[model samples]
Target: MLVEYNYVIICSDRDFSLDLKFRLKKYEDLAFVSFAKDKTEGLFVILKHRPDIVFINLSKNAPEYFKMVVELRQYFHNLPIIIGISNDKQYVFKAIKNHFFDYWLLPYSEWDISKSLLHAKAQIPEKTEPKTLCLKSYRDFQYLNTDDILYLKSDNNTTCFTMKNSSEIIAYKTLKVFEKQLPEQFKRIHQSYILNTDCVSGINYGKNLCTIAFNNSQVPFSKSYIKNIDELKKKLAQSAIFANK
Candidate 1:
């Protein structure tokens, strides 16, 4: 399927100015523009437009960049998806840690952008059918659809996939692996757990966590992943508003 979503581009340097915007235009459904030098303007555009993606260049001094990420997190929690451009491994790691969907090298290429779009599409769950994901291992592999999923938890080396049928499948997969395949609705709330955003009942902001009431049980949100949870909350709020309109 062809997915069309609005996008906001933030770039401080001018090296690839016109080139990037021209290339982005090839995606007929994407509405994108280039920001001259104002970081705040770029952020405002994201908050105002609520685009499907935010593509930004990572600065050398990243603590400040993180502050912006955190701020956007507060308002856009499930902010479409963020793609950071940076060559430094440290900055790329930090962006992912902050919940950015993907990070690419400074010079943008069609292949890289295409890959990111595919990843984003995979993250957006479709309502037509329950999503099916396959679990692979040295001995045996299995496939489970979304309808069968109750929740997922990670423990050191292994991850547990709980099903609605009261069965659990323990597999060798990292939180990151499942994250890419799962829809945007599923968010990581703990270092060891991932919960569907729709499954969340309420958040205990004062305690720096939230609880997901799933299938007669409650799952705790880890403090480390609270930022991501809250961001998704914002996205949910915006969605509600749009529906009301």
Candidate 2:
């Protein structure tokens, strides 16, 4: 199945506005929902259409770009693209720090928009099944299907694999080694822990933590890994959609 990418363009300037819109529309997969002249109407369109991407102009005349970014971040945190357009390097740096997917200078060609749209598409995670992972250690090596593991925790020189059966597998493998062994659904949820997305039952955003409930065991989601938890939730949601089909 193919999904349509919807976009909302919020530009204060009339010049080059339609050109940009036209460029985005050229991709048959993407469709424009609304175009606004100011931040107020821009947000209205964004909320109404729930666009997959939003292109905003970073200019003094376009209200407070920083405030707009902050406000939109709250409402559309999961939206794949929040592109800031400006020629100022300082402004672009600030936007990047705030976690906008990409930024571009003004008077950009259609090719630039095409390049960015492609990049944003690449960022969205695709749904896939977990694979069996085998890791080697000094004494012995074990192989288990990825879905059978709850999480992996590293302590000094020993890395422990918490299995769905509540049994622990102690291996001398580093955290990085196991990370590479797992699939995309396996996420690093803590400095010392890598999570199995399938095992995570729910997340507590207020506590900045996640709860991975296995058959007889539970795993904790740490503060440092909250972002990865959120991302994994989105991937799991996307996977569920496919499974239902």
Candidate 3:
């Protein structure tokens, strides 16, 4: 899944917010961007967060809710998916006309919500990033499949590549040189370390460290690059559910 961190905005009251949060507690990927009580507040939150999905509460007002979302298209080049939440099916036609991605009942159904989320995730295209990396050192070019590489470590001017097969290759380039070249999956967690987000098995915030999935080798992350590490967590959590640990 080549998905970045997906921000979510929910427009509802305090009680609905709490219920929704509890139902989606297991999904480590989805981010609840902010609190929005209605269309007025939702529009502001949507602009600020640029959320990928917005849940509109139709409890108080249904027709106006649909109209507001249609008007939102003018604000964004690509408007986020608007999901309507209501007890009655009366707003179904309006939701369809307004182009809502999905609809939910007031008292949420775990199964229905799960299906909608998974369906939406599958709709997103993947494998858009370049999978192969070419390292050229004076016409001696080496091609590496990005999936086979686990992490990168910098030592002065040279960068070390740790492969999934436990082999290492030294490149005659600074970490900064390849930082921008690599795909989004490669995150610079520290000055000396850049790990593949896919290979991360554990993140210990208290210890200020992350460990690879297969090897369990620890990588130290500094406070300055903590946000990168935070984004990494969301990356790994993309498009899937896990059995409870």
Candidate 4:
């Protein structure tokens, strides 16, 4: 997924600010830029927008610029700050020491800006993987952990998830849709039921029922699905043998 990074520019020069905004807008889909006339206004904009990256002009006023950096770092330590410097190489060492993301000498090129933006994006921490299933129903969505689900029962076009908490969640999607996305641990034991193999306690071959000891519930399997039961028993026996060894 492409992450659209929101950024803000802090500079007092109007003409330079407009030019920077124009240059940054060239990559509109990758970045969204906002502007602030000075450090005071920049702080407010930063607080409001919570931008992923920030660009500050350091050529005109170095002291005030670093002051803003100090203030920003107090609240947002990880924010990527790109410094705009003049041809004077003196500021480069300070920029490096301050841990700035990147610095561009005066007369910004499209390559330099693009490189800095890409570097800033790389500094952002990767998003954590989602552990729960998000099910949407009409106006809102519900989140349920994959481990919490004991089994699923299908009723016509709707599928209901029976959770460990003894509560059920009804989704509009079909059982086949869920079967495709669910982990391999979920097995189809019947046309109406999908059982979590991890939760299966025992099987009653005489009654053709699989018992879930987690919830003390029994689900029936069809004649066509009896092979699944045999497979389950074989797996259990293999597991038992392994444990003994």
Candidate 5:
């Protein structure tokens, strides 16, 4: 699936918004989601939608908008890409200090906006979370949400996928083939098994086993994959309120 970026525009200028909308028709992937009249409303809408990009009209109260963006830090570790629009070149320095994506002059250069958006696309990659895994064989095609997959086991040349719903799906392909295709959350714990780390509730170092919390099933992990297990432990520990050895 092609990734489409959602954007929110915070501008009181209707003419600029209309013009920008007309110009953005050329950009198929960049879709506008919501619009706000002022910085306060912008903050509320931004927090609600969490768009990929935010265009702020910095011509008025640039400092206040910057402060509003800083306030958003309490809620998000990573903020949206902010593009400042103003008639004053003075705001460019401020925008840079605040780490804005790009600063556009009010007169609006079509080429400049296009170039900036291209650069933005290069910097900010497509959101790949909760991806869909497509399985195709001959004329048959099966689409599975990667989030619903618990783990995969290799049975000779075929791979069996265990879902969160307790249903099993068999793909006429080797486990090694899908090993590289699945997201980072799915890890190769054994030669025959690749487990989804999200589904793992606990790891028994003594038995070299991982507990799948989804169904309370224990899966074995060989000593050879202890490094991956250690990293997984540390990754999961960061989200825990407290952990004791």
Candidate 6:
């Protein structure tokens, strides 16, 4: 199903803004599309509309432009942002560092913008039920809150969801499938287990085991997956620093 989303373009160049607005109109799933000529007006539009996606044009010479993007990230954590630039390699690297969903070169084709829009759409959770995942088992469907899930274990072809309440739900899908559907908090620590990092209380690297707070289960991580644990630690540290800020 196509999800309807609102988006705003913050571009100083009027001609480029108009061209982008025109291209975006072709997507029937996009709605409440608006434009702003500068950061001041863009902030107002963003606060008023709370758009699902934001497209901002970045100038290589303008340090303030990059600062504005960083401020937006602080205000709207995890909101999908697309960067627009003109053949600037430096800006591309900065965009990637800031976790912009996608970037398009100036005078981009309809296909290029469309592809970025599709990617941004996929990153955004559905507004109606943003925090829930629907898992199918036989003819019945199970709705689960992403936060309530502690971890998932795969045995043969089946995957088991271990919830915060200590209840388990068996689904007929592989752990690989759930890895994609779950939010960023979920990570594959082992070939057979996908863990929710939020529920992780401790990690014993010597034992190759991590403890989950929800059920106090010691899930093992593979040697090849040790890098995932390192990355998770970095992510947690960054999150802490951001929270303090």
TM-score of each predicted structure versus truth: 0.46, 0.47, 0.53, 0.51, 0.54, 0.48
Q: Score candidate 6 by lDDT.
A: 0.79
What is the per-residue lDDT of model 5 for residues 66-164, given as tens digits with 9 covering 90 to 100?
A: 898888888888878899988889888878888898998878888898899988877775676649998998999999999899999999999999999
The top-ranked prediction according to TM-score is 5
How does model 5 fare in lDDT? 0.87
Per-residue lDDT over 203-236 for candidate 4, one digit per residue giving the tens place of the 0 to 100 score: 8888989899787889898888788778888877
Which residue pairs clash in candidate 6?
A: none
Single out the weakest 10-residue window by summed lDDT for candidate 2: 236-245
- Candidate 1, superposed: residue stretches over 4 Å from native: 1-3, 33-36, 125-245
Q: Clash number for every model?
A: 4, 0, 0, 0, 0, 0
- Give each model's whole-structure lDDT: 0.72, 0.75, 0.80, 0.79, 0.87, 0.79
Which candidate tops lDDT?
5
Q: Which has the better TM-score: candidate 1, or candidate 2?
A: 2
What local lDDT score does residue 13 receive in model 3, on the 0 to 100 scale? 72
**Cand. 4 Cα-lDDT:** 0.79
Model 4 RMSD in Å is 10.4
lDDT of 6 by residue, 11-115 (tens): 788887787677778899988468887877877788778888877778533355566666766677665555556655557777777677777775677788778
The worst-scoring run of ten residues by lDDT in candidate 1 lies at 236-245
Per-residue CA lDDT of model 3 for 27-79, tens digit only, reads 76676677777778877888888777777777677766776787788898767
In terms of lDDT, model 3 sits at 0.80
Name model 3 segments beyond 4 Å from true.
1-7, 125-245
**In angstroms, what RMSD does candidate 5 have relative to the true structure?**
13.5
Q: What TM-score does structure 2 among the candidates reach?
A: 0.47
